[model samples]
Target: MNTISAKYKKDFNMDKSIEEKLVIRNKRFQSRLMLGTGKYRNIKEAVESIEKSEASIITVAVRKIEYLKKIGKSNLIDFLDWNKLWLLPNTAGCQTAEEAVRLATLGIEMNKKLGQLENNFVKLEVISDSKYLLPDPIGTLKAAEYLVKRNFTVLPYIYPDPILAKQLEEIGCHTIMPLGSPIGSGQGLQNFYNIKVIIENTKVPIIVDAGIGQASEANAAMEIGASGILLNTAIAKSGQPKLMAEAMKLSVISGRKCYTSGIMTKQIQGQASSPYYGIPKLQ
Candidate 1:
């Protein structure tokens, strides 16, 4: 049973700006910074870090829970806060269409606690490989098209391939996320130029997700006009996760500011600010 409790149909008809940019579930956020809610040592730390960062949204993975005979059962319920920032449940482990669909249905039911079904906010993460962790684009495309028909806010994580991005858009992804590097490698922007092209040509928000190593890299992505960034290990695995979260928050804001304000042009030949005409000896 596809028990989607997304209240969007009853409450939201999907609003658009005059420029037709899709409003984020009727929220006024032009900033493209997306945060992950995994890898924190504890739920409290995760919540506190995310809150302190002041991120507009946080992504969480919907996976399995093991039941211990001694301890009974405990899911990732510790991470749930119905009152916090918008919940973005990702199908992180699904590699096939069947798995994705089953999990997506479970997510809808599980998300009722977090109010996801009501809001229609879910990010689809379909990875086929356990080793390389490559997304099954075929599965992703199928899932994306299916989810869109079902009225879910779909964001797909993909490699820096522009045509795949276009295919995703064609199937109804509201935004496409191109990886900055491998997930959790902190390798920085490995496919920088391709990401730029994706950002340039995509109609939807072009989110640079994964493999961001530092605040400077986040800034670079924004400078290139990426809609926003989604990061995890870069902040979560930091020596001081809380402090790192704060740094990332400011970096995003600073990047947005720099991007909006045109950068100073690069020059190969030195063009003196004090002209030869202005210098007394030269004059």
Candidate 2:
């Protein structure tokens, strides 16, 4: 692996390296950057940011908005182009399996109403901790099992635990989203080693979600072999969300290129760029 890594590092190039596409639940996507439809200044800015990001998948928190919209209320879906993007409804505030399962069912119906023609894909976020907004692994596992049995493509947001990731994969989860840090903290890859293990071991796509502070952080995650990244705070909280979104787009591209091209291994001893025999001694 070290030798391969060295060769790849030597051959790395932004334009010359071949890039790998992301595939989730049998669906192929050109862009691996997934954005959340929350925390923007407004719907217009959110839409513009998403457009700039060029993300094919956007996660929407399923809550009262769907219920209100059923009665002809103005909701967020009205402002989005469902045809151009895939909506991944998440049980953002659900604290239990029952709640997540229920919301997921409602989310599927909502997607249908919005003209989604694909499988009912849901991002399972069972957050029992309101303080840190961390996921409840028990609730997430329970909800994932139920959703998979119901033929929904389950993607659980979880901690960076390889065992838990493998468990979710065994339960038929479409993808595994491990947090880089606490949700919305912008701490950026605090659990990098665990995430790298998850990416290496899991057959399913591993998407690093939450706690990415900047576009460079996103690039770092991608370079370490994460299949994709799902972020909102990094872009939404920036001074210029649109430009930040574009930076994120390029970051993902560059990071994926580096990953595909193979990064160089670190060494304790330094290697000389100029050969000793070729250099003339200074007078």
Candidate 3:
């Protein structure tokens, strides 16, 4: 063996192969998958699917709670294992900066009301275009700025724009959530280059949110340096939600492993695994 190869062979350790846990602020998550609570057939299915996913974080839209309370029905929070999971309250229906800010404040209040004392994180979303459901960058930034000052860990969901991403990071957003495609479209990485650029340029965690259609898409997101993925419609709308949830769990892990292992580079031409010089001739 060559001197360099022989030297490194003696120092290689098998114990250092374990994947590192994902950390955002003070919390560390074993599963980087973040599932959303919406559009499920029922609460039972949602609970089963989420349990199968083994996700460490779950997003709950605060706007739906008031209606549920008014109708004398249980909300998503009533079924969640509050102590085990981190609940990320989102302003899903907010269309303006003022509305988003109000919802965020009310979300924290509801968090305390539900006995989730440590819940100060919010997914800031201000979507002006209801037809496409695209994020309003101006409103999102405005809401994020307001929330950060009030000591809320703001994770703004936005369109994949590098400049906006940088601006959000500069404004002290806890994490940057750039969408893979239009909300609930299940299109999968429509703006991959922009998303990659955002991942490379931003200092904060980049959790790809919305429009993930399949397990492979989730895997690809993690492979390309996303800190995590937030998904809902893909699993919730599937015929077998529980099984799809399990697939998502495995896919995220697979993608994370591939990323951690340092994937091999691509080549234009074929490379032989065995040496032709040592091979015997065929008759």
Best-to-worst order by lDDT is 3, 2, 1
**All candidates' lDDT scores?**
0.75, 0.88, 0.90
| Predicted candidate 3, C-alpha RMSD | 3.6
What candidate 3 gets wrong by more than 4 Å, as runs, is: 1-18, 280-283
What TM-score does model 3 achieve against the real structure?
A: 0.92
Pairs that collide in candidate 2 are: none
Q: Pick the candidate with the highest TM-score.
A: 3
Q: TM-score of the candidate numbered 2?
A: 0.90
Candidate 3 lDDT: 0.90
For 1-283, candidate 1 gives per-residue lDDT tens digits of: 3554577553344332211322554554534567886676866777677767777667777674312223675434555466655666778888887777766766676567655457666678888788867677788888888888888778888888999999988778888988988888898899999999998888888888999989999989988887778998887788888888888878877776677666788999988777576556744
Model 1: worst 10 consecutive residues (lDDT sum)? 13-22
For candidate 2, lDDT tens digit of each residue in 142-254? 89999999899998999888999999999899899999999889999999999999999988999999999898999999999888999998899899999999999999888
TM-score against native, each model: 0.83, 0.90, 0.92
lDDT-wise, the better of 1 and 3 is 3
Query: Over the stretch 1-283, how does candidate 3's per-residue lDDT look in tens digits?
Result: 4355765764564324346777777777888999999999999999999999999989988888877888999877799887788888899999999999998998898778767787798999999998999999999999899899888989999999999999999988979999999999999999899999998998888999999999999999989888889999999999999999999999998888888778899999999887899678999
A best-first ranking of the candidates according to their TM-score comes to 3, 2, 1
